[model samples]
Target: MCRLTFFVVVLIPIIFGFCPPGNYEYQTNCYFFQNNPTGFSTAELNCVSIGGHLASIHDGFTNSLLTQQSLSFFNASTDFWIGLDNLQTMGNNWYWTDGGTFDFFDWSNGMPENLQTQNCVAISMIDGRWSNENCFLSKPYVCAINSAATTPPPSAYPCSGGFLYYEPTNSCYGVYTHQEDQTWSNSESYCESLKGHLTSVHNYAEFRLIAAFASYGKYAPWCGLFSNDGGRTWQWSDKSSADYLPWQPGYPSGSGPCVALAHSGLINADCNQEQPMICKIQL
Candidate 1:
């Protein structure tokens, strides 16, 4: 008779206070739990309940590995959950769990065509491609709890008189608000009085913050942009458009007289419609 015996001991170091409650980063000691197969929204709630959030991949390398891991966990046949979801409206709108806009766009080639209502975002193993999937479907997910702060965000935009919050990334400015609602012209005047126009968010991060502080009662905001110059002639109040923007569908419509920034960051709506507006300040 022959017999073989083996022993293994695994030690998991309990790092005390590595990340604050409900905080996460990339490439750090982040906690991941695979249980109770959940959809995108449920998954986010789950992560949040555990003092964390759905993972966010900032770069290509991590994005690739994450997609692969999710596919493997789900038997390489089905999709799993991730932090990305376009459940905002229906068009090309996406947001991350960490209160940031979807700036790191890596959509599969010829994808996001909005071929169907599958607007929710998901990752795939077939060459780390990202595709829109049903938010109700359940799949394994690769989320980060605490990784690392990749780049030091740019300082908030400079506001002189009233107040200003600068976004270090895009050099964009946001207005400090104490109210839940403001009018388009009123917000515009508020920003103008301070020598700054309403906030003109050029990217997603600022959009996230703006949405949180401004968006109330399903209303968009009248950002520092307008089609008055012409249908395509949209410009920021700062008289700068160096960073060309890609507007979403059914936007800048002639019928929609007033324009307000949508919570999704890419879309804008009419003014009277009631959306969040930025209260700019002088810089």
Candidate 2:
């Protein structure tokens, strides 16, 4: 009786669909379950159209909640699409479509087979266990909607040549693309020549300043963030904290050991792709 009461109390809002009509409120985000069968890519696109991504679970509670909701929502006895996939071309690993951490999962035994053809993930409607499925298969999906970020102001401080000062992190940033487009290696070398390394982002406010560099208008430039084994871990070229990762929906899903900043967010790109770069020096 005690456990049931606690569970029911915790589920009040989620069970009542307290969000805008047809949406379920859970924590700070809203989830919308779509019963229509759709392919994984199509399902993700549908979610993104509403300023969110296909639901990405971070903990067991969320997993259980989705499972219970599936029983209440989806009529099919099969599976539903979630935002987990091993689409990164560089390695056979799974990542969240909303760019959340890849820490928790409840994969069924022998599941996530990692077959190249079965890269997308779906949750069982009956047990909520995860399984890697062919991306083309149609499945019901849930969308997790949330808020957005605000742009940051720009300023410069006297530290290094061609660097701008971002007060929050007490660091200087430089956008280098003048002489020629450079690969990630070349960009880091250029930054080293300026007594710094490729930029390392600490948070979203700093990221916004880097993305909307004045006049450049939403520049896509190489940053220090890189994952050696694809989507598992990230490190800065400057060896700074790499905590703030703002990725475009379903991003970090390509062949990547390199990262770049864009209006959408951090993206995985081929290291050899010549582009402008951002450099940072801790101050």
Candidate 3:
């Protein structure tokens, strides 16, 4: 009877997703820290592949929790990537990867400097405060799994108003047609306000779905692709892999901070140019 009780006590958590092994639970979420160092993009992908995203610091309590966990599992010299990043081309406003509002901030003194070059953020091992860094820099990272209800696929569930369910990707998409054109930065803000971001095309099928909604032979629409460091490195706003680019010939001139999809194909465009936009939400 004693052995059975002990086994049941240990098995309950795993059976109900209370907290997986090798993870710590704090306020309806599970967090895992990886010791291996990797770039910001790769780190984001790693977390997503495991059904989570990089940790998003909310308040002092959460910050303390993460800090204590880091100290417990890692050395004092270790720094782990968090989900906050400032990839928008216009402003230095940081956003969480989970699409939450930017309500809390805990930057170290004299930190988040060089806003133009440093786009990604990480938690410091010394004080557990936040600091901005170049996304290309490789580092260990923390993944956060929200304990809230799982998001059902588009086919399995319906989206809210103003969103169309795409069966192929199981995502909800919305097209924003503007009478007056807005810059890429402005469009991004608009989409975020609606709880989404500029559409990120991952494959030919997804690209075609977006294309079908676009006005034929008309101005292109802003997308999530852009040069993060002054045309040096291009990345998706959602941090997805950029392995499926289908740019038209002589396009992606690598001369602009924004990209748009026209009838011809994906093309580099000035970030300031006004255009229609597409926003996507993963179900």
Candidate 4:
């Protein structure tokens, strides 16, 4: 009788759908997105065209999963759109424009910097945070609709970079390079060919770390921020289409037709001039 009771207790959770949220691939909820490319606004519209609006981030686990997959589809102009917005004009008042309120939000240290006249929000790095920016900007963003959710492709990799010297846990990842320099097109091509994409520098810590590894003294390497708005907007090479803005003092000068990494080994470059390149791949 005791054994039977224990067995039933164990099976009760399975029967009642009472397992804790987990990281297992199967246990995770899946989201469906359109492969069609659209501008930030258009993407939102398209998402509405379906039954859903842009992708609304739910929780850390789900956000991380979405960000990881978003990075994989990234290219030189890979800033896909998401569902969060600051349309209310209040600073840091982010809500899913999809008409659903979000319960989970992650802000970087001193984030939502609101450094500029940002009105929209986008996801940065695998560590989820919302960036405020203009909505008119045309960056690649992901659009989520109501359908059977699906997992990201098997090739997906997170936006986080590996360690500099050595870390056992990071052995599966590779470090960003200081020696590699390629034209914007070439660099992007390089990453794609390797079944990887350009690395996204999400915050000051990440920017500083990658810069140090690249040995930047006064030169910057190319990163993944670009815009067709005559340099008015910058987007990472992902699908989050998160458009809140973050600029380090003087950035997106709006002068160059192209973007590059500059500022020593900081992966900062002038958008107009050709520079060396870096590529990221699974470790």
> Which 10-residue span in candidate 4 carries the lowest summed lDDT?
4-13
Which candidate comes out best when scored by lDDT? Answer: 3
Q: Candidate 4: RMSD over Cα atoms? A: 18.6
Q: With candidate 4 superimposed using the best TM-score fit, by how many Å does residue 201's alpha carbon deviate from the native?
A: 41
Best by the TM-score measure:
3
Each model's TM-score? 0.48, 0.47, 0.53, 0.38
lDDT of 4 by residue, 1-283 (tens): 0110000001010111222232122242224444455445455544433324567776777777777776656544434457766543345466576556778776656656653455566676445566666665666666544333334333332223331211121211122333433556665665666565555555432333333223322244555566666655556664334343334445545456445443221223445454544443435
lDDT of 1 by residue, 148-262 (tens): 3232223322323323233343332443333345556666776676566776655554454454333332345567776664455666766666274535455656644345655
The clash number for model 3 is 0
Clash pairs, model 2 backbone: none
Each candidate: RMSD: 14.6, 14.9, 15.9, 18.6
Candidate numbers, best TM-score first, in rank order = 3, 1, 2, 4
lDDT of 3 by residue, 202-258 (tens): 775466456544532257788888987776667887677887776755776855879
Give the better candidate number (2 or 4) by TM-score: 2
Q: Any idea what lDDT model 1 has?
A: 0.53
lDDT of 1 at 156: 28
Instruction: Give each model's whole-structure lDDT.
Output: 0.53, 0.69, 0.70, 0.46
Q: lDDT, candidate 4, residue 99? A: 53
How many clashing pairs per prediction, in order? 26, 0, 0, 35
**lDDT of candidate 2?**
0.69
